[model samples]
Target: MSFLLGHFNYLIVVFLMMGGLWITFSSRNYIKRMIGLALFQTSVGLFYISLGKVAGGTAAIVLDKTSKAGEALNAHLSPDYVARAGVDGVVYSNPLPHVLILTAIVVGVATLAVGLAIAVRVREAYGTVEAGEIAELDRTEAGPRA
Candidate 1:
């Protein structure tokens, strides 16, 4: 259908999100879970970036009217058109979502790094990265808690 074709990026985002969640929950290895979490974060970033996009739109940069480029842009339009359309008849994509996503990406990378470091420490202490094995070791070390 046209609707499905038009929103293909959304479909991919949903697929990535579900797959990442499944990998994170179904895998017992800490490394696999971290990778899944990263994937999910990436999907979220992509979704926000997509949401900020506009068809036939330019970047939200302000051009000085006295600049050559701005003069050239204005030359293509009539005063009436400029008054009717605003901003020299140029359509700009929203930058807020993109900016927020950029921050989210940086935070995501830091969180992932911290998570991986913790996993590394867990591996060093337990000699294995499997969650079940770590739990078993903990239970054995407890030695029948009353």
Candidate 2:
């Protein structure tokens, strides 16, 4: 249907989110879980980027009033459009989502690095990266503590 076609990006986002969550929950390997977490983060970023887009919109850049291009733009715009926009008829896309996503990407990478480092340490300490194995090792080490 038209509705489904129109919202294809959202469908992809949802799919990625569910797949990531499934992988994160179902996997026993620390590295696999980290990958799933990264996938989920990427889907979130993509969703934000999709939300920030506007139909027939350009970048939200202000043109110099004195420039020829600005003058031409103003001349081509209708009075009502100029009145509404306070300048020209150009529709600008919101940049806030993109900026926030950039920040999230940096934080995600740092978090992934820390997670991988911890996994490496766990592997060295427990001789395995599987959650079940690690837990078993811990329980055996504890020796049925009261």
Candidate 3:
């Protein structure tokens, strides 16, 4: 279908996001979980960038205007000129998503750093990084679970 062909990137993004989620959920190693989390974050960034992109578009930037002889005297008429001059009749990609994703990337990296630090502390304390083994140890410490 034309729709599917036109939006193939979206499908890829979905697949990537799903794969990352699967990895995060199925893996028992804390390091592997962090890697999966990073993959998920990357996929999210890709999705945002794709959403911001246009098939045939330019960057969104307004142009400056110079006043003509008659327009100089009639300053009130400048609004019309300003509006027309600002538009270049070119389709442009949305920039808000890109900006938002940039911030998300920064936050994601900070979160990853903190997560890794926690994992390291967990390793030092438990002598193992596997989540299953950690859980068993915890269960033993607290006695049998109901």
Q: What does the lDDT come to for candidate 3?
A: 0.76
Ten-residue segment with the worst summed lDDT in candidate 3?
62-71
Candidate 2 clashing pairs, residues 3+ apart or interchain = none
What are the clash counts of all predictions, listed in order? 0, 0, 0
Give the per-residue lDDT digits (tens) of candidate 3, residues 1-146: 99998789889999999999999999999989999989998998999888888544445653222435333423444455444433443334687988898899999999999999998888878888898888888878852232
**Ranking of candidates on lDDT, top first:** 2, 1, 3
- lDDT of model 1 at position 9: 91
Better of 1 and 3 by lDDT: 1
TM-score of each: 0.78, 0.78, 0.74
User: How do the residues 5-112 of candidate 1 rate in per-residue lDDT, one tens digit apiece?
Assistant: 779999999999999999999999999999999999899888888888865455779766567866676676666665555465664567898899889989999999
Question: Better model by TM-score, 1 or 3?
Answer: 1
What is the Cα-based lDDT of residue 108 in candidate 1? 93
lDDT of 2 by residue, 35-129 (tens): 99999999999999999886545566876645776566556556566556553555456789988999999999999999999988888777788
Model 1 superposed RMSD (Cα): 4.5
> lDDT of each model, Cα atoms only?
0.81, 0.81, 0.76
